[model samples]
Target chain A: MRIARFDDDRMGVVASDDTVVDITDLLEQYDPLDAADLLPDLITHFDELKSELESRSASGGGKSLDDVDLHSPLARPTKIICMIGNYREGTDRPQQIMDIFFKSPEGISGDGDTVILPPHEASIFHHEAEIALVIGKESKDLSRDDAMDAIFGYTVFNDVSARGLGREGINSFLGKSFDTFAGFGPWISTPDEIGELYDQHITVHVDGELRQDYNTSDIERPIDELLAYISSITTLNPGDVICCGTNHQGLGAMQDGDVVVTSVSGIGSFTLNVRDSDARQWQRGVDEEMAARVRAQGQEAPAQGNGG
Target chain B: MRLVLTADDRIGVQTDNGFVDTSSVFDDIRFRTAKDRMPRVLAVFHERRSQLEELAQSGTAEPMPALQAPVPRPPKLIAAFGNYREGMDGDRQKQDLFLESPESVIGPGGTVVLPAHEATIFHHEAELALIVGKRAKDLPADESALDVLAGYSCGIDVSGRGMGRIGPSRIGKSFDTFTPLGPAIVTTDEIADPQKLQVTLTVNGEPRQNYSTDDMEYSVVEILSYVTGFMTLVPGDVLICGTNHQGLGAMQDGDQISMSIEGIGDLQVSVSDPHNRDWQRGIDEEMAARVRNRAGSR
Candidate 1:
């Protein structure tokens, strides 16, 4: 099922009208550990809470998502493993090189969020639309089959990168990790239902025009192998996220006031804003064509520019 | 409340055995004192018992401290690089001089402050900051050297920029409170594979940065081998593995940087302003006098 953790840090199923029940009570009642605990424990017990959420959705009635703020799906987890060049066109290197790239957890972000571009230095900050898997079990030295079992769900992630932070040239952690550089969520779909994990058509748009386009099958190692490769070395704890990699076309950038839209077929899409220091430092420059696309997709209205 | 940091070109530390005085760790070494005296800390591992157990048992040596740093500020920080085809595909070229200064580095229990400018670009990267456990000369085999690991600590390298190509990163990464470290160091015995732990970071209670040790292009063994080849890695020297791909994001004032490694523990720090500039004569005199007075007190 499509599951989501939203509204100032609480978990609940997203309904039709965008109205939300305070599932915080339900998640807490069913939670084996405090929401503050590590995410792996929560994922393991997620099924234990499943029936309870269904009951709450049926019995409780209060509050609306419109009235609350959203947070990244996983409250707190041990790690956010990411793919560097899994996308076909993400790098300047050859195909085999796609097998190696790294992003730390600090790169994650979520919906209605801002990608704070650094002002102290001159660098290109870009958004990458990628699929991220949230592991549900502690997995190590696992086979590809077991690795797939460890996956709890999938979510959308915007991996922001600060290019050339240093010329070390090898490690991208410094250049790619700036606070709020990574963005994910909107919702997470569970494993059984995450049929879109692979073979999903993906696309990224900045302001309005499409930027990145590809499918998950294009990833160098694919999800199962990537999971196996990682499990061989380090253990992946539940609630841990792995951004498989962004498609090739997602590279380059999002200017201030620009809205980035990344979508994966079957899963849905995420809309985020490219914000700068000065509110007006950027202009969406969207007037007609963008509005039509938003309507065609039946997505929510874009966040209005705050005149920064 | 223990803390370790790479400051003034070396690892600065706080320990149970008094301050490590990182500069002193190298005093007995044969290298030039100017270069050898980088402030830092080093822990002698138990595996090296054969080499050090005699000195330790005979009362000829003191118990190692929990944390340590270089006595002098590090000239630069580097990690394994992967820009080229050979580097990206694990060619083991040792060309990955891939290191950058933390936007700020502070001892554990110390606060690393960041400037608040919605206009300034910002981000934080969680990484493994190695505190050299011993002094090893000549490039030893990866297994022979890493086998002597004293312990490990957690740290973050914060960066701030308004543009895309910020270089030297030293100024942007070295603000007070920008790099927060300490809490505790997991002695090597407590850790099995240094390259196989969970590395993560959170800001204002949000999980922003995360990744595991195995993700690095160059394994810790490879990195240490390459690093030691350039010079003797003295005890208490810190090597910060550049952050993984969580991506650079943003932070305002009052943000907390909690960097953690699964078995190694975490260093949680709050952000604030450095307000650091030139020191005043009167203040300096008082501080100098305080040191002078304290010199006699001990």
Candidate 2:
């Protein structure tokens, strides 16, 4: 039903005319403690909350979507599990096994937020358009047949990455975990709203130019399989996010002042602006060392690359 | 003062005789009137360190019950990679880092379940842990990185060498119950020097890992400073300093793994097979083939 958290942490639902019906008052009546944090609690009481929201939406008294700022549908997920090398193209490695990694929760930023490009020794930032799932139930050891039921809904995630730092090839955690590296949401779309998730078209655009375009069907492993594999190793709490891997096709780099938009066809879209970080001044010495190393490497510096 | 989280989700403080139910301290008028609002133990230490210390010292004591991971379900759990001398692979000089799943953490007396995958080869790594007390990012030069710490504890970084040998250690070292932390979190005031502490891990009463934090290539302050350069450290976040590889070895099911730091108390955990499990999905013929291929080429 297009549930969202916006404007100073108020829970609401978006209507056909793009107006937001504030459900905070109604939600508090049902359970005050749960109302304080709506997104996570929505996972446990999805049915009840859905019915309550539907009833409230029938009445009026709401605000336009433009009047207020939009926050991430789920802020501070316990974990942001990301799939590495889950797409077939771009590498010669076998696709039989799935590789996974993590992004720190602090890396998350909301829709329309400015993604700070942390100054590093080298500077090559890239945008990865991916389809991400939000867990609805506390899942452990989920089988393939039961995996779909565990998902609360879907959202668009921009897996912002620092390509130069990632070239070390040790691991992607450090390269991908800078603050504001992970961006998602205008709002979450329930699974019922996005029928046949496997066939949805996903795309990424930078400064009005198409960068990444692919169908969910292009993913090496299906959603159910990925969920089953991840849940086997660790428990998936409600509000946890699992970002399905992105295809390497049409991948491109981004720079300061550029606006990047990631969209999933029936679900939704989110836009983020890239800006140079002010915190870089604190690491000038380290940054200078990296610049020196890149300069010594001549024109073949690794910063000139596009994707990981 | 030492703080602990009991198995049933109660906040507690360790006293001279027994444990004190300090959960009530959250409701005290002193904290309420002062607008000191912190949900977890680490946060309390962050916003009101002295007040918390005073409360812990003057609080009532009662008998202790079983304990859980002191800082369970932290927002972030960052670990250093290749930060120790000896037994490390690849470049030994770099300050590599990685993220361990918060869901993998288990409490003292918890069991580290060995997954039933065929390629799994389990190992034990004993290390010291730092509990961050403040929200720090891009640490300023004037600030001492150690000042961001609230307390310290011991953590056993249980790793599976099979998948770790193939790729990054994220998956292999991140199975459920892979990280066992805490009998209790000893306050920073009591620990004179974090680097000089003696650390040891014994399996079935046999010493498998023995080293000093002094042998670490990256000091705790250096690790925190490097980490804060990119990621933000908030209250309740844990930074596990990488382990010394001096006597690393394999662990078997039904073995009691005891990890102890000189100042921090001992944490005892048992190992066992995945309870009533048959086959694992991710670990199959393809995975085995890849591991075999990599091993053969090596």
- Candidate 1 residues lying further than 4 Å off, grouped into runs, are A16-19, A27-41, A55-67, A89-100, A120-123, A278-308, B1-298
lDDT tens digits by residue: candidate 2, B4-98? 88877667788887887777656532221111122244665656656666767787777888988887666788888645654334433657677
lDDT of 1 by residue, B109-164 (tens): 45655543222444566777666666654445466667544566776666553311
Docking class of predicted structure 2: acceptable
Worst 10 residues of 1 chain B by lDDT: B277-286
lDDT of 2 by residue, A97-137 (tens): 56588888885788889998876764566688899999999
Candidate 1 global TM-score: 0.49
Model 1: residue A266 alpha-carbon error in angstroms:
2.7
- Give the local distance difference test score of model 1: 0.53
Q: Name the docking class for model 1.
A: incorrect
DockQ scores for all predicted structures: 0.03, 0.28
